[model samples]
Target: MNYNTTEAFAQELDQKDPLKEFRNEFLFPKNQDGKPQLYLCGNSLGLQPQQTANYIQKELQDWANYGVNGHTEAEHAWMPYHEFLSESMAKIVGAKPHEVIVMNTLTVNLHLMMVSFYEPKGKRNKIIIEADAFPSDKYAVESQLKFHNIDPAEGLLLWKPRPGEYTCRTEDLEQLLETHKDEVALVMIGSTNYYTGQAFNLKAITKLGHKHGAKVGFDLAHGAGNIQPDLHNTNADFAVWCTYKYLNSGPGSLGGCFVHERHANSPKLKRFVGWWGHDKSTRFNMRKDFKPMPGAEGWQLSNPPILSMAAIRASLDVFERAGFDNLRQKSKQLTGYLAYLVEELNNPNIRIITPSHPDERGCQLSFQIKGANKSVFDALSKANVVADWREPDVIRIAPTPLYNSYTDVYTFIQRLKQVLA
Candidate 1:
């Protein structure tokens, strides 16, 4: 496909967009003059779908009418509310319905998954992770290490990139696994790195980890609903993610977890148990012995939050309607257009840190604005371009194909050029 730096071309693309109607389905942030700002922040907090209120209102109504009986009598039936969302949620992450569950927040779910999978024995106590893993993940792994009385400085192995490169290479990971073949107990990676937006080959990572005799898991916080991590196909021991980001659920929405079917029925597997995870047949009887439910639902510890799930349902309804294939196709074109525009500037200082290969990244393209500071980010924000700024000279922009337009990409680049000038 031929590409050009023309506003008319951008508009033409928008006109031809099959998913154009989705733009109106979301409420965009407005500038002071009340126009929709060029929103590219979906990688952080996705825009609210207009139908979210209706979903919430229905639950609110059920609570008002049913009171204490709402658990069994609500329109969504609170007793099994989370189950209603399982099929669609599982589909989003590319896992079987039995393998995925909507539950606690991301970090909390990570800890839960680790409780069962991170079995350290003798010399195999060390954990391997990507160097630039999200801080929360690092903290969780470090805490897990400390919990087991292992010193993080000694027990945590970082799979770093080649000097000065922003993304980690899989060959480096393989080399690291080979070097520490006997020492590793777990290999926990952020499938799509939060900082660099690098999407790893999940199946490859899992295969490598298994070959080295280690449990492999992924923090799919960035990969879920962005790139298809294919959790089941990867045969990852476990995976976790938050819904608030690319899933377009409300702010700080509940997270999701996946445990491969192989471990789903392991009664011997240890976990932090709760009544919700007990056998539903005798849950209310409250017996002394904890009869664990089967599959991913076995990891859950509490009743579902219908309010949050309602919001998730609303966003997922739109996702189900639009379909990920269409969204991804639009996403590549959108991000590619932004990458092209950035290159058009011809400024040696403005270099894209994201991989040029389509499969290596999702929607985000991190720009290393050499010598420029956060002030450039501030100016961009003030110009109504909502992007993210990381410390030490990087401006992160994402063109979410769901609600963002080709025109948004063109206008953003024009504004960025003005800011650069």
Candidate 2:
């Protein structure tokens, strides 16, 4: 596909975009002059959907009208409010509905998954993760190691790139697994790296981990709604993600969890028990012993916040209308245009650290500014180009397909060129 640098070309592309109408469905942050800022930070936090307030209001109204009876009397009964999100959430991640559960936040779900999957015994105690994985994941894995009395210095293996490289290589991961051999008990990785924007091949990673007899999982915080991970086909034991990013749920919304159908009824697995996770028929039977729900729901520690789930439902409805495959197609082109324009800049000061191949990335493009300069990012912010800055010198831009336009990508480059000038 030919990409032109002209603003008119962007407008033409936007005019033809099937998903262009979605841009109006989101509420963009306004600058002082009352113009919508160029919001390319969906990789960090997505713009709120316009319908979110209404969704929350319905729940609030139900609570007001029914009070405690809202448990079953509400239109979207509070008792099963979380279930309303499962089918849509499952569709976004390519998992069976039963395999997906909308539950605790990302790190909490990560910890819960580790409890069941990260069974380190004897010498098979080491855990493998990317050296540049999200900090929360690193902390969770380290604490889990310490919980089992293993020092992180010896028990955690980092799959890092060769000297001076930005992304971790799958071959390097395989080599690390081979070197660690039976010493590794778990392989947990972010599906798409947050800082670098490099998306890992989940199935390949899962197979590699299983080959070494290690339980494999993924943190999909950066993948859900941005890329279809096909969690079931990946054959991973588990995966988790937050809804606030590409999913377009409001800030700090509930996260999602996926447990493979294979583990759906594995009674041998140990999990933290909760009333919500008990069998629905017997959940209210106060005297009955805990009987876990058959699938991913069994991991629920408690009922989720309805307000958060409402926001998620609002966003998922939009995804359902837009269709995931269509969004993926648009994302590849939207992000590709950003990459093309950045290359056209031919600026010595800025270089794309993210993988050039669309298959290897999502909507995000991470730019490495020379000499770790922070001033360039400051200028971008002052110009109202709402991108995010990472430490050392990377500025992350994500042109989300759901609401971001090609013109937004074009305008951002124009602003960035001026900043560099």
Candidate 3:
């Protein structure tokens, strides 16, 4: 599709967008001159919902009006606050409500899930992760290995892209599993790699891991809202994602978790649990024996942070109103438009590393600017284009369907063209 570099063309698309009204729902960033900046960095931190301030303010008022009683008397009721988010979040990830829970931060949830799913047994103690997994994930896995008194160098394996490629091939992953079938115990991959913007084949990975007698899990920090992941159909043992990115939840918001139903009722499964994971009926009794709640809620460690959950509530409400299917459809169109524009740049220096096939990605596009460095990013920032720079030479741009418009992508490409020239 050839996009016209004209305001009229962009305006026409905006007029036809079913989600055009959503752009007003967010508080867009502005330059020092007070002009709204073209924000294409939703892959990093999503724009704040217009209702977020009101949501946070409501919590403050509850604290003032009810104090300790706010747990039960608050407007939204803090006692079961996390439950309010579960249904919407479950919808976002394509999971049953009982199989999902919103709690803790991203790394914290990953570590917690590993406690139950990464259990290393007698000859099957090794774990496999993508070579370029997000730094936080790598650190969490390394620490978990050390916590278990295992040597990371010997027990952790990294699946890498081929010599000149930026994405991992399923064939390579299968080969590794076959070679290490006797030693591999678990496989944890980033559902969509942070830097490459490559969305992995979850169902295929899960099936192969299971065939090798290994459990499969995913860190979906870049995948959750950017792409629709059918966690239940994938049959993954577990998965975790942060809400701040594509979910549009505020900074440091609570992360989400999914535990496959097969393991939901595993009475023999060992986990590091707390009272929050115990049956609510007897939890207040403060008994010694812990009877875990079935499903994803069984993994909770403590009461969630209500203030953060409030921000999440505000965001998920936006998602619920807009509908995931609607957002996803627009996402494909918005991102496809961005890709179309970048390719038309016709700059031999610029090369998109993200897969060309739409099925292999979501909204993010990672590209390398030939012979350019961080100064290239500095130039874009000076022009009020808000894309992010990954180290070396890559810049990642994501046009979120909920808040971004066709004009934003059009203007961003114009600025990028100037910067490159």
Candidate 4:
């Protein structure tokens, strides 16, 4: 598709967008001038869905009317509330209902997954991760090494990109594994890199890890709701992601976990046990031994936070209506347009670090502006373009297909050109 620089061309595309109606469903932040700010920060935090307040209010009303009885009698039934999100959440990440669980925060779920999947034996005690993985993931892996009494310097292997390159190559990873041999215990990676917006090939990584007799898992903090990792078909041992980003749940909402069906009932897979994960039939009984529930449900440590789950339910409903496949299709086109416009700027100082191919990224385009400072980002903010800026020089803009129009992309580029000029 040829992209035009004209704002009229953008309006034409917006008029034809099938998902255009979704923009109305979100509540955007307004600039001081009283117009909606151009929000291109879905990779950081998605705009609130218009229905989120209603969803939370419903639960609040139920709590007030039913008191403690809301646990069983509310319309959504607090006791089984988390169960309501299973199907739609599963679809978003490309997993089966049973394999997905809405529980805990991103790092908490990472720790939980590591508890079960990061077992190290004999000489196979090292872990492999992306060199520039999200800090939390790196910290979590390092902490895991310490918990197991292994020195992180020796146990944590970094799969770094070549010195001058910006993205880690799969072949380099293969060679790293070959060098490490069977000494590596687990392979954990961010499905979509946060800084560079590079989406890794999950199936290939899983197969490579498994071939080395290691467990493979992904941190989908930037992948969920943006790029489909196909968790089930990727044959990953486990994956974890938060809902607050592209999932559009409120800030710090509950995260999601996906455990492949193969481990659904594996007795040997050790995990931290809790009452919520016990078999439902006897869960209320005080005396029964803990019988773990089948699948990802077995990993829940406690009953979910109703308000947070309510927000998630609200977002998932929107995703359900929009359909993940359709959203993904629009996302590719939407982000592709942003890339095209960025290239049209013809600014040698601005270099896109994100993968050029749409398949290798989500909506985010990370631009490394040579010798740029926060002032450049400040200019964008002053112009009412809400984007993300990492330390050093990268300015990250994400033209989300859900709420962002083609016009938003055009307008942002126009403002960007002014700043550069």
For residues 1-421, what per-residue lDDT tens digits would candidate 4 score against the true structure?
7887899999999999999999999999998779989899999999999999999999999999999999999999999898999999999999999999999999999999999999999989999999999999999999999999999999999999998889989999999999999899999999999999999999999999999999999999999999999999999999999999999998888999999999999999989989999999899996899999999999998988999999999999999999989888999988899899889888888999999998899989999978877787899899899999998789999998889999999999999988888
Which ten contiguous residues of candidate 1 have the minimum total lDDT?
A: 285-294
Candidate 2: give the clashing pairs.
none
Using alpha carbons, what is the TM-score of model 1? 0.98
Alpha-carbon shift of residue 401 in model 4 (angstroms): 0.8
**Steric clash count of candidate 4:** 0
TM-scores of the candidates in the order shown:
0.98, 0.99, 0.97, 0.99
Candidate 4 residue spans exceeding 4 A from truth: none
lDDT of each: 0.91, 0.94, 0.91, 0.94
Please provide, for model 2 over 262-298, each residue's C-alpha lDDT reduced to its tens digit, 9 standing for 90 to 100. 9999989988888899999988887899999999999
Error of 3 at 311 (Å): 0.4
Off by over 4 Å in 2: none
Lowest lDDT 10-residue stretch of candidate 2: 299-308
